[model samples]
Target: MLYFEDLTPGRRFETASHTLTQDEIISFARQFDPQPFHTDPEAAKTSVFDGLAASGWHTSSLTMRLITASELKNVANGLIGMGIKDMRWPQPTRVGDTLRATIEVLAQKASGSKPGFGVVQLRWTTLNQHDEIAMQLETSIWVARRPTEQA
Candidate 1:
């Protein structure tokens, strides 16, 4: 199982590849984000995005799946997401585009009072098959450390 010690600063972790499908994008958007650029291709084309796109939340969900598949479930601290910073949906992700992501360990430190736990900060970016960045976000997770008694 992963613990706070496993997240060394500067270390990088990657997510396995997955493809974005048209139907998946439409279905996800229809249920949650219903934006013109996400639900219909034609409407998307004229809607400033130039083509059908996945919702930003959908991209985030894909990131979650990738992270889970990458063995990150080891720590599963039920991550208390404090909040995200400077979140921007740069380029739109199109259907049939495959994506993968990398998470860089930006920082890790002890919690103010939670003696048995710490926090890890990371910034991740998802890239399409063409190596184009489709989404990026900063995040943090609370992690329990190996008991000091064990150390």
Candidate 2:
């Protein structure tokens, strides 16, 4: 179980790879973004992508799934996402692309109002098979601190 004390600034964690499929990309985009480049291959050929691509939101969701399945699920007190900042999708995610995520602790501070919790700022970077960054985001989360031992 990971506690707030376990996550120090500069610490990094990685998750297993996930391969993107055309069906899944189209399905996700159809349900959420429904953009031409994300939903239709022929249409995407005329767009800037030149091919069907996963929606930015879909990429973020995939990143979250990897983090939760491989990392966050091990947290002792769990985590509550506070907010996100500076989110960007630098490269398009296409079918057959295998993606992985790296999470780095940027900063952390014990909550003044909530002694039992701490606020942790993290930078999440998702990379494709070519190791090109597909997405990046800064997020803040509340993590429970380990109980202090009494003397």
Candidate 3:
């Protein structure tokens, strides 16, 4: 089980890969984003992207899924997200792109108000098959600390 004490600055973890399919991309965009560049390939050809692209939100959702499946599933007490910062989609996620995620612990501090928990800041980067970064974000989460043994 992962705990506050186990997460150190510069620690890194990688997630399994997920390949984007055109049907899934269109389905996701049609429901959530509904933007031409994300949903309509022909329209996207005229847009800045020049081709269908997955919505940024879709990419973030995929990243979350990968993180949960690969890393958080084993963590004891689970994690509570505090907040996200500096989220950016540096490159478009297009159909047939295989993506994976990596996370690095940036900093951490024991919570003063909640002695049994700590706040950890992490930098998350999602990369495509070619190792090009697709999305990046920084977020903080509350992690439980190991219980202290009574004297």
Candidate 4:
């Protein structure tokens, strides 16, 4: 299991790709963000996206899934989010788009008050098959520190 001491600034990780399909996009949008552009392909043709688009929330969810199920899952403790900042969905996620994510450890610092944990700042970039950024965000996570061995 990876501990806080194992992480450093500039560390990077990549996740496997997942192809978004029309059915899943429509289903997810129907349940959560039922915008016409996301749920109806016909209506979407006239929308700003010009095609069916996945919800930003859906893209975020997929990003989380890729991260958790990737190499980052080796952390001593499961990924526990502390906070998020500067989240942006720059481009629409269209149907049949293959999505992948890359994570960069932007910074890390031991917690002053919480002795057994540290805060890690990470930047997640989710890109489509065309290498266009579909969504991106910076998040802080709590990582467990390595236990000190007694002499």
User: Candidate 3 lDDT, tens digit per residue, 35-115?
Assistant: 999999999999999899999999999999999988766666776788999999998999999999999999999999999
After superposition, candidate 2 runs with Cα above 4 Å error: 149-151
Could you tell which candidate, 1 or 3, scores higher by lDDT? Answer: 3
lDDT of 3 at 99: 93
TM-score of 3: 0.97
Report the candidate with higher lDDT, 2 versus 4. Answer: 4
- Show how many residue pairs clash in every candidate, following the order shown: 0, 0, 0, 0
Instruction: Indicate the worst ten consecutive residues by lDDT in candidate 4.
Output: 1-10
Model 4, residue pairs in steric clash: none
Query: In model 2, which residue pairs have backbone atoms overlapping below 3 Å?
Result: none
Q: In model 1, how large is the Cα lDDT of residue 133? A: 83
Task: Write one digit per residue (lDDT tens) for candidate 2, span 1-151.
Answer: 8899988999999999999999999999999999999999999999999889999999999999999987767777665899999999998999999999999999999999999999989999999999999999999989999988999
TM-score: the better of candidates 1 and 4: 4
Best by lDDT: 4
Per-candidate local distance difference test: 0.85, 0.93, 0.93, 0.95
Candidate 1 stretches with Cα past 4 Å from truth are 76-78
Q: Is candidate 1 or candidate 2 better by lDDT?
A: 2
- List of clashing residue pairs for candidate 1: none
TM-score of each: 0.92, 0.96, 0.97, 0.97
